[model samples]
Target chain A: MAKAKLEEIESPAMLEEFYRQMLFIRRFEEKCNVAYRLGKIGGYMHTYVGMEATAVGIHHAIKPTYDYMITAYRDHPQPLLLGTDPVKVMAEIMGRSDGMSRGKGGSMHVYDIERGFFGGWGIVGGHIPLGGGLAFASKYRNEDRVTICLLGDGAANQGVVFETMNMAALWDLPIIFCIENNEFAMGTRLEYHAADTELYKRGEPFGIKSERIDGMDVLSFHKDMQRIVDWTRENQKPYWVEIMNYRFLGHGAADNDRQLYRTKEEEDAAMKRDPIARLEEILLKRNVMTREKMEAIDEELTDQVEAIYEQADASPFPDASEVYDNVYTDMEPEKGH
Target chain B: MAAVEVATQTMSYRDAISKVLSEEIEANPDVFIMGEDIGRYQGTFRVTQGMFDKYGEKRIIDTPITEAGFTGIAIGAAMAGLRPVVEMMTMSFSILAMDQIINHAAKIHYMTGGQAKCPLVIRGPGGAAKQLSAQHTHCLEGWYAHAPGLKVVAPATAIDAYGMLRQAIRDDNPVIFTENPGLYTVMGEVPDDREFVVPFGKANILREGTDVSLVGYSRMTQINLAAAEKLAEQGVSAEVVDVRSLSPLDMTTINASVAKTHRAVVVYEDWKFGGFGGEIASRIAEESFDDLDAPVVRCGGLNVPTPYARNLELECIPDVDDVIAAVQKLG
Candidate 1:
């Protein structure tokens, strides 16, 4: 873990703000789990449990609506942090007419393109090249927008990842290939899936600037990510990053019995460095908020998340007639045989 | 068939496509063409021969031979507001990028709830040509037509090649624009007007008759025309219906033809068993059941991998003789 001493942003208000944002996401995802178990949500819903800092840290580094963002299935937090109404996101997960994709895309397909969040793509590593292409388009248009493409450690082994990295560097596009190395690829450990567990060095062979950074500490991670984002935008070139963290929950909502791959002891060890706890520790040290204030913030965010769940659950499903809507801009698909 | 007078020029299917491509690229600043060897090497079949010098790298991009990579990039580019025409050297190689096409490009618009669209055209030669063998020769338009989000068109003539390519490049949906290698050199009088796009899902009747109808698409449409000529010599009047678009299929025209003729023979260069011809054949039976006199006959290529030997390859493809025999089977 490369260390960066926190100096400038150690202000009380900034620390309190970080605490609230991270806690809000934590509460939001916990509610998603509850929603999935109650059958209110359908299909595969991969919740962002232990990897809070990576998404929040990256959000702090880039302009939410100007810089483009894309990620593989484990979505929701990007748009939520980018200012997509958590109710609308939860509605999408609930597969309602008010959902972002009008219920056409369930949990794995949330999209708010007007905000520059390209998607909630399901296929692992399939969206990497697409992320590069988004950068390619911005470059072609001579826009200085940076594209942040997030994928998992398991996705690093996909052939298209390397193929896209080569093109991004060769084409000199402004993009960041951020591999959220949660150390687990859907029950398969990093060592079991990758020939090299050190996934950050993926860009080295492609002449892309690359490194690994500690993701548990949100402030440090944001500082490094902001620097990388600035470098990519200024140079109009691609960079590779591996944000080291761990997911305390199973891969998806359907995933049960972590004993299939990992042990309870290993899980317990990873939990010690939980990003939210680490951020709280920094807040306490800096006297950002009293213990009672921290407790009050937790309750408020939890209530907010509960309201989001109720609102999403109350939303109506899309009409049967709308099943064909948006299949094409100019035409509808044949309805029936 | 024109309601208004129009100037025309005799040209090959390849040249017709090239001319229309140049016109579209010149008109739409958002439109650009990209693929492996499509720029400097002038494309594998010379379809983009002079386009490099004409359009330059800004609009005419040459990419590494990474189909999945570039195809995904093209889809992303399309989603971001650029209309990209990605040329595959052969539609056979598109199988390498099926995940990108089927999973990403085809699903983006629908999944995004109309937030983003892939105004993309993936065009290249399909079906068998000479001894291109099993790997290079594949009639994949049927495969793409099966996907819901895509619009599939396989034009059979130089005129149609020009019209549909223009329509595809300007379309707001992802279109599978397939050109049979055999149709490249086929000549026709293509319209010289920029606004001469022949809309999709509208089948053309090349020859009208009452005895029977020969329905087909791509090069098989030409074969059906030849079969109509052969059927005419044998005292049978065969209507030639060229089904240029397969996805938004012009079943109205096909059913109309079946009603008049009371018999039909579907010709396709793809495999006989479980091919796109079966879809059309089944649709005709379902649609024109009361108007028909006999069951619809399907004359598709032999159910085997296309062999490298020219003689064997020819045997695999459905020809005029095959169509004639298929029509005779209806009796």
Candidate 2:
């Protein structure tokens, strides 16, 4: 229950950028849904429509070049916010040759190592220890860098999470374990899956500093994350933050039976706390922008996104010969066997 | 077998492995070892004895009894440019960390489009030990070798253990270096040079012959060699081929020997059904079919779980007598 003074977002430029980035993620996911339905993109597609604040808030706090970031499969927004080209990400989703992973890894495995984003791991809670190791590397090399490992509420219950948390605390690794608690893990809610329901408290037994933050508010999330990032970098210790948020869409594009688990009324009530709309309200109340200017910015971004989608669509698919590439670094697999 | 004359020393397989690990840690600042009971208790099999005292706690870490956690942490560390050698206590315990080993460590480099390299080694004694029962013993090298992004090595001799382990630590890929508990006390002459690293994907011709080929790795290689010696006394010149590395299997040597002998018998301690020996047998049949005088015979462990009784245990895994019988059947 630690509190930071709730002040107006101090920088007008920063607030504007935050609003634009969240909107861009929202539109980007919407486009992804459309493309998935249109058969342009294949495989499992988990959109980050409602959890934009969580990815942007924490990522903005870390130095992208130095700090490391790793997350679960619902990961398109993270790479995009970390400065990965949207075109390449989109191409990856479409399984084209120009994709970030050269179409080898689809939506669930977007990685931009240059920007310090480790991966978009498919298994739940699988990357927790990896995140600790990334921090261990930085600490071992005496670098002033921290790693942020983001997992969903579902993954918070995995045994590896506790195992990794214990080791991270023991070694005093510089890393943050962020749980994006979007209420439900696929279809099971946090109440049914977690015994305590307080996800952040899981790290308490491991002696890691823990916090529960309101992830719906971008400014507050960003502020809290900046403090955690600073503390982690200076102390070289692990911290756990549970960002209480909600997913605005189904677990994946294929989860058409989402209505079976929850009702439309509940969904409507949750949407009322939409992060993008909340940011816009703050911007308007503080005279940072008028409604007309905000609408103009959205229009420009929408057109730009549309153009990017077209470019991604037009990009050529990987050649058939590429199926044998990137398997090993030293020897190539025998050809034409 | 290469002659080792200058500056050679007799050492147990366990001590030889420990020596190479010590050397690697001293040579590379980023190299470290971590596992359950590896620090104060030395190691489960004492393979890491004296490492903690020599390198201190920071470099020779002792982890909790959580395989998945430490293995993933090591993989993550490896990706971040450190070379980690993780001891699984027993390869049987490695099942708990299979997701981390097979999914994360093995796939990271290729899945990340070559941006990250997991230069880590997960090593420990595999195969059945005397009266260890079912759960403590497992020859799961075939399971590890099944993965595409991994290098699997099972060294039988003390020298192979020394040279291959050093090479595995330096390799850029994740390697599953399996050791046989049965071979730990077996003595062999290891090269005195600290930098004697044997290259991977090369099979060693332990004994040359012309009648038939006896192929195996790890403890089974020893069984094959013993059978070869007995077969030689019985007027059968058996060519013994030790397939040290199983993944990038030394098919060249296997094929060459099979072609010369015109017959082959693949051996392993794992169950016959879907064992790695099956892969070797299939490769010989498919690639060297034209050179074969008879069908490729395989002598592997029985399909039943390892038993605690000495009599049942002896019946489970292939021995020199079983290998000799298989070779005699081919004749």
Best by DockQ: 1
Model 2 TM-score, 2 decimals: 0.97
lDDT of 2 by residue, A17-132 (tens): 89889989888899999999999988898999888888789877888767999998998988888888999999888888888878888899999988888888999999999998
Q: Name the lDDT value of residue B55 in candidate 1.
A: 85
Residue B271 shift from truth in candidate 2, angstroms: 0.8
Among the numbered candidates, top TM-score falls to: 1
Tens digit per residue, CA lDDT, model 2, B115-167: 77889999999998789999988998999998888899999999999999998
Cα error, candidate 1, residue A245 (Å): 0.9
Give TM per candidate. 0.98, 0.97
Docking quality of model 2: it rates as medium
